[model samples]
Target: MSSLVQIKDVTKTFHRGSEDVPVLSGLNLTVAKGEFLALMGPSGSGKSTLLNLIGGLDRPTKGSVSIGDDRVDQLSERALAAWRARHVGFVFQFYNLMPVLTALRNVELPLLLTHLNKAQRREHAETALKVVGLSHRLKHYPRTLSGGEQQRVGIARAIVTDPTILLCDEPTGDLDRKSGDEILTLLQTLNQEQGKTIIMVTHDPHASARATRTVHLDKGQLSTAQPE
Candidate 1:
């Protein structure tokens, strides 16, 4: 397993008024190609912050973030946006779907940034939906779908572009136990069968158990040992 994502000596700080809030300090991580990794911690533990750094949603205040051969932390804003559009896929806890769009159209949102024609985009979105067992819900709007269905749509949207990495933040946080398990199974299938590299931030141990490896964050630092 070759290294696909690397974070070296990274630190993140937020300035609020006159106070400096340090989130992550001297954090280092390496994610292998096609690895399913879970990040777990209590609130304010910087788990999501680390995921953001890896996904190019945010840059570290210090150190380098590298995915494959690209140094993400060094890229300009425009370049980083382009890079993220091409390589990173994000699935949020809230399932950020446009209310007016159907499931198919929502999944096609990411491809609009590419040169793919309408037909090509539709084909890709359809395939992604099929992968997540949502082919029948393509015409349904977010409001009409169940929590699990909405999350399946979100996953479809994330993988529609065949992104190099998938970043999920509490992907099943809003669902019932059964629904969450279903979503976790979908993620495992994507990892084991489709070979998608996933980095997920989860507070639930059940969610983390589905991952191939788990890392915990506390006070801006990572620990391999799970908390009791």
Candidate 2:
């Protein structure tokens, strides 16, 4: 597997009034194509920061972030937005579905940015929902679904566009143990069967255990010993 995502000597800092708070310090990492990577860390350890940088949701204060041949840190805001829509798919802890949209409609949101027409988008969304085993719930709203179902909907939405990589942040954080386990199984299937490169930030040991590789972060740096 070749490298698909690369981070080099990256640093991220935020300013709170007069204080400079650093999140990631001179970090370096690489993710291979079709690899499922779990990032684990305590609060304030820069796990989410690193994920955001890789997903192009945030930029590094210094150094480079490269996905494929594109230098992410160098893209203009407009270019980055366009790039993210095509190359990245995001699944948040909260299953960020719109209350008013049905499962199919929610999954079709990303397709609207592309040239696909309404009928084409609906077809694509239906296929994605079916892949997540939610074909029966296509007409249902988020409020009507269980936590696991909602997260499944979220996963469908994330994969509807067939992104280059999937970035998940605490995907099972808000679900119960059984629900979390189901979601983890779904993620594992997505990686193993569907060949999606995944970078996930998770605090649960069980969740991290499902990944191909688990790396720990503390005080803005990666631990030398990664668990496989």
State which candidate has the highest TM-score.
Answer: 1
Task: Give RMSD to native, each candidate.
Answer: 0.6, 1.5
Off by over 4 Å in 2: 226-228
**Candidate 1 global CA lDDT score:** 0.96
- Summarize candidate 1's per-residue lDDT along 177-203 as a digit string, tens digits: 999999999999999999999999999
**CA lDDT, every model vs. true structure:** 0.96, 0.95
Give the TM-score of each candidate. 0.99, 0.98
Number of clashing residue pairs, candidate 1: 0
**Clashing residue pairs, backbone N/CA/C < 3 A, model 1:** none
lDDT of 2 by residue, 70-163 (tens): 9999999999999999999999999999999999999999999999999999999999999999999999999999999999999999999999
Model 2 Cα displacement at 12 (Å)?
0.3
Q: With candidate 1 superimposed using the best TM-score fit, by how many Å does residue 17's alpha carbon deviate from the native?
A: 0.5
